[model samples]
Target: MPEYRRSLDIYQGYNYKKDKQTPVGYLTKIKVAGTDLTVDQTCKDPTNPTTDLKCVAVLSGALWETGVTDAVYLSGQVSAPNRQTLASLIINSLTSVEVVYQFAVYDYDPVAKKYYLAFHANQTDMNGLLEKRGEDLNVSVADDASTEVQSPINYSFQIGIKPQPSAQTLHIATADQKNVVKSWGLALG
Candidate 1:
């Protein structure tokens, strides 16, 4: 079997307003490409923080306030007879993979003049692989017997804010919850 390296790309979308917009809300789109898909790691326990945990990529200057959503595998090579089985396998494996996010929340009560901070996280097992979009999986096979077949597949996700108590919300609120915002604000002096 041939070995392939995984390549991942993340894209972020934002909305800016003249003066009314909060300038805090945004969305993230992730694309992962690789071959012989398999689950590298399961969901991590929230109480335990380890280096082995798989975390959603955090971008600079932006707070990830949402868990991954709308995760799906897409391919243009699945329709090919030779690639169908591989595509099916990839899809099946991805369905078992779980993506999780960790974040913090900061709540302020103006009337009471009190502030509350909390940490939160959540995970979602990919169960929607059965839905197929775009062309079937297709990839070129090595002709030489000594050469291994190389198959590439693509998966995507939409990471965004959810309701309160969710991981996304926590992540978005981390800066405020941790008082990083206050520290940074003063550092500007």
Candidate 2:
């Protein structure tokens, strides 16, 4: 069996404005391709810091302050077969977002590796202006292949509720809660 490993890429200390109409901090934004897609937004305190000042163990302590917070946007493209479905996707607000996805298409040559965009359902909330609306485009992936994946696959993620901090991580696994939760690389023990 190929050993499966997961890693994260983080960009630290991006700034944000608290008083904006959209409280979610948007550090940077990037446009994806000929189609409409974008990334990089805001982050918020998911929960109270684990420990107090005496021995603070907050995962995102620095950002917990009520004022300004940092944000980071994800960048990638979306690909789908003729069909489009609106799906609720959960991404790591702090970098440990997990989901089950399928490969939109199979590779023609096993010797060579290629990446393609996966399609996902778009909910009714889509503001009509999807390009700048901050909606994520789901990328379809195969569960069987993903379960046995040993390396990171290039995927187009749906725009998360907020921009994930650099400290956050991404996980892809089978949709089954058991497999999805268990197969994650950055799970909290």
Candidate 3:
């Protein structure tokens, strides 16, 4: 089998927000870039061997917001620094987003090292925080003797998010000055 080089573009976009905030919330949006992976095809002896092709790609980003509420204390203690104050302040949290891509191999080309991508998914139509990864391109098969065959392999994408520093802010801090404006917000509740 011959070596092959291919380029594929995958675009993904999703909304992530906190379920609810104790006192404040931030507006955020996250855009994820595309990813590329290599695929190989091999055969043993004169017969085509049973083979499997698996790939896993992970994408992550942090969402931040400014001017969140924080904890405050009253003027009464002189040494107790960790005491609960009667005042409130602004705070922020980090939200990490993760996505994965999975596909199963079904066939291959002998002349060119290209594998077929085939994966099964449920056919449902619903709109409510759905993780969508754009379709993946197929591997090309070409030889010096014949024209190249454009075989589009199929795959599926999965996405999720995890909230970091689950602290409630009482005050709205400066996003530009504090760099909180660069982060994505989880929810507005």
Candidate 4:
């Protein structure tokens, strides 16, 4: 539902603090509330809006990422009741839902204290949804498997997200910082 252009300006935000280690490129590591989020983080939507998407608050959420090739795993802590909220949705034909996700990738350097947006996962073009898997459906494929996701204590649900091809990648012009942060629901640290 959004248009595309070849020109892109990866945002260089005001964040320059090196308080903690942030894994650069592909965003392999992510944390919420000091807890190590276990899922691989990536662009939730292909459009990858420069502006932020609406964000909903969950008390404790263990988000999922079942990806291939450049695997982006996103795992977090979800309270039992919160987990139930997602459970009912993966019923009937609707296998999953994009609850609260807006992909904003960055090429960050902690030491240098600089970062830029690589892509945005807009709500309209997102490719994955959060899903709960039963033991029967949780078997490994080929020799490739996710040991972290297989453990019950680690996570109770799963979601797979695949990156869009480079040829298909598109960008939209971004708003100024206030509007961008507001629309993006980005929490300033």
For each of the candidates, give the backbone clash count. 14, 25, 29, 16
Models 1 onward score TM values of: 0.21, 0.16, 0.15, 0.32
lDDT of 4 by residue, 1-189 (tens): 232122211111111123432322122222221223333212222123243322111111122221221222332323233244434433334433333233343333444444444334432333322332542222111222223333222223333333333212222223212112112121235
| Residue 175 lDDT, candidate 3, scale 0-100 | 20
**Top lDDT model:** 4
Identify the leading candidate in terms of TM-score.
4
Error of 3 at 139 (Å): 26
Q: What's the TM for model 4?
A: 0.32
Model 2, C-alpha of 172: deviation from truth (Å): 20
Worst 10 residues of 1 by lDDT: 180-189
What does the lDDT read for residue 48 in candidate 4? 34
Rate residue 72 of model 4 by lDDT: 28
State the lDDT at 70 in candidate 4: 27
Worst 10 residues of 4 by lDDT: 7-16
Least accurate stretch of 10 residues (summed lDDT) in model 3?
70-79
Residue-wise lDDT of candidate 2 within 1-189, one digit each (tens)?
322221211111111122221111111222222122222222222111221111000011111111112112222222221112112122222222322121111011222221111111111111111122334433322222121222222223333222222223222222212121111122234
- Residue-pair clashes, model 2: 25
Residue 157 shift from truth in candidate 1, angstroms:
12
Name model 1 segments beyond 4 Å from true: 1-50, 54-121, 124-126, 135-189
Better of 3 and 4 by lDDT: 4
Q: Candidate 1 on 37-153: residue-level lDDT in tens? A: 222222222122131233222111223222243221211111123233344444553432222223222233344343333222223221212223344322222222211112222
